[model samples]
Target: MTKQPESSVARPHPGALALGVLGELLITAGLVLALFVGYSLWWTDLVADARAERAGDRLRRAWAAPAAAPPGQAAPAPTYRPGADGIGFLHVPAMGRDYSVLIRLGTGSEVLDGGVAGVYREPYRAAMPWDASGNFALAAHRDGHGAKFHDLDEVGRGAAVVVETRDHWYVYRVDGTLPRASKFDTGIIAPVPEGSGYPGPGRYITLTTCTPVYSSRFRMAVWGSLVRVDPVDARRTPPPELRTS
Candidate 1:
């Protein structure tokens, strides 16, 4: 019998070929997802921290240089105005002796994603620490972008939460905490901050963040009452609360 061409090499079954392609695609997708997570959780933080540090330094420099009133006019009282850079710093000794983050005007990503706490401007305008009476509500990411409020859970009742501005330090004593609340619960950031256990209106501070770490399915809040306001002396000394052992 004439030698027939060696039987054509057996081809892979279509099903097998499809499965091989599927496996490669899955592996690629997994690698891409991991890279994204790393970027979101790590790289973003580095960038945000650098930005925050630069902004904070600029703010301190501005504070150090005061404009003198011309022609012997009386110096006007310093007003709290938030410029594009930021407003001030937030210090929670309960978090750490050196734990502080810059604070800006709005809770939008543009502010918080830059590794800073953001004041609420929707539903209700957040009261500045300088405001006579209202909630100085603030929010920050708990798991990424510097995670400024990552240790918020450590702040218990009686803990101090201090807001440092150019002229003063507004100290607040933690009053209560809501570990879990609906993300849509605007009441948690209201002027009086509902569910905060406060009997009525007062100079309060509400710190809000996403719950359950690495997820944003819910929200958490820490409420505090104004304990005191310390004037920033020429030396810019920190308050006793910040002096941790």
Candidate 2:
């Protein structure tokens, strides 16, 4: 028997092709939206919460000891105490490093403002707190709002910066600057210099950070001797001098 001619099938309609493309576009858009939402929840929104929690933890740890008095005081001051025993705070006036939230050296703080937030400074904890004595080298970001020490270079030699603990304030002079093309072997941080050209002295405060505002190609070191240390009560007044009670 002769085979019947096979029937030809019609091609897909143009409307069907258009519908397929539309379906794919909708799926892609949905996926992108989902990714964005996930990132906001995981990174952007939650990051601040984590950081603020850490800052609070650092603050709480300070003053953990029995309240103590500043040096030369006969006894611990009433209602005034030392930084949570061992940890401390560093304050700077002109560089805006003052009034900054303090955490242990090398520890970080929460981002208070905008894009310039959330960087942890590298600190030398062994050095005495500003209120005490010895060298205190603290490093912060050089640029961005997070760049904590961005304007530190602007400080002229003989200018002053203050470091405050729960108990006292230490005044540091901006005596000199150390320029380096490359970072030195700074693993040996101390109450004494490990030979980065800083002289071992009675008391020194060193400030270090990456230079050129936003670049880390070279580190800029600005440091000076601790001119004096005194009870925070002596001169811890804010520029505005509002009642802090």
Candidate 3:
């Protein structure tokens, strides 16, 4: 008997095959993007937290065991020496009830990447809290590297930003804030930070971070004035302002 004509097999259209491959590629790309975000947001924080803790511990240890005074010289003040590789802790009540982190010397990534705030040490170098008259400027990451200043916007007038040293706690009260500022506005960190609403030379603390969340195009500044200085107690308890939110 004559064989029946062989049935023709149907093949997937070229367009459909191409679309299937494209779908797979798109899914892969999406997954990679998600992983990167997770790493930036969460993993980096984890790594930075560890580094910060180590640095904080070293600071505490140094304070616990200070260098002996030289002969015929009075003991050095219990303060973190500027121009040295000094690192101190900072506490902001409005940032968080338990907000505390080390403040490093420079605003470079080397220091800020440790999940701590860094003082501007370049062209617009910042003054330490211990300075008698000058702006104590600080910079921190707003969204990554522990996001130390992420909640800076929430800090309102009258909130406290306290810097902790071996012996003293420099307490500053929020006076004003510029929600947005140009990134190149170095004057904001000047001894008499302009646009800060303060009239003239006075003790000030300026907290700056990348603004608009998840972007570094602009900056946000929180300006405060020295309200008081509290001596560290034997128990190392924080000041009243840092006791609550």
Candidate 4:
């Protein structure tokens, strides 16, 4: 018999080849999705946390530096400038004893990338802690970019939310929470937030983050009212509320 041609051997069906290609593509897509999840859950946090630390240090240094006096005047007092490089620090003992993060002025990617909360600048800027009657509103990431408020829901009613400034520690008591609210519900941070039980204008603090753990479809808000303002002491000791809880 003449030598048989190898080309005559049976080959895979076209359908089989197509299926193989499709399988490879699916695998590649799955891998890409996993990598994205990893980046969102881990890598972004590491980078953001580092940046936050640097920002916090800068704020501390600024506070430590004394202001220069005029040629023939008393030395200017050290101050906490709202729109300055660092506005203040937020402390939530209910989240954790060390759960303190810096608060920046603008709620933009640039400000939030530092892994800290940012105050709204349009329609309603955050009222200063010293403001007699206004809302000190803030927003932070719940799932990425440091996730400073990741456990915001853990804060129970009557928990303490403290804001530390250059001159004072503004203590607020958690009154209630809106488990899920539309992101467009600007009233959550209003001077007198509806449904917050404040009834009228008062010193208030509103902490907002994305809801449902990792989704931004809705918002989670924690509302509190300023109970008192304590002058910062030399030791910077935590207030009784924070110290106890």
Best by lDDT: 1
| Candidate that beats the other on lDDT, 2 or 3, i.e. the better one | 3
- Model 4 per-residue lDDT tens digits across residues 1-245: 99986776689999999999999999999999999999998999999999889889987887787657888898664444433477789999888877899988877777776698888776776677787789999988988889999999999899999999877899999999999999888888888887798889889999999989889899989999999999988777878876853
Q: Would you estimate the TM-scores of all the predictions? A: 0.92, 0.53, 0.92, 0.90
Q: Give the local distance difference test score of model 4.
A: 0.86
* Location of the lowest summed lDDT over 10 successive residues in candidate 2: 111-120
Candidate 3 per-residue lDDT over residues 50-82, each given as its tens digit: 988887887788878756799989787654433
| Top-down lDDT ranking | 1, 4, 3, 2
Question: Least lDDT summed over 10 consecutive residues: which range in candidate 4?
Answer: 75-84
Query: Candidate 2, 203: how far from true, in Å?
Result: 1.0
Name the lDDT value of residue 92 in candidate 1: 93
CA RMSD of all predictions? 2.1, 8.9, 2.3, 2.5
Candidate 2: Cα lDDT at 123 = 40
lDDT of 2 by residue, 181-212 (tens): 35554632355655435555457777767766
Model 2: colliding residue pairs: 62-84, 63-84, 92-98, 106-123, 116-145, 116-146
- Model 1 segments beyond 4 Å from truth? 1-8, 67-74, 77-83
Rank by TM-score, descending? Answer: 3, 1, 4, 2
Clash tally, candidates in order: 0, 6, 0, 0
Where model 3 places Cα greater than 4 Å from the true spot, the runs are 76-86
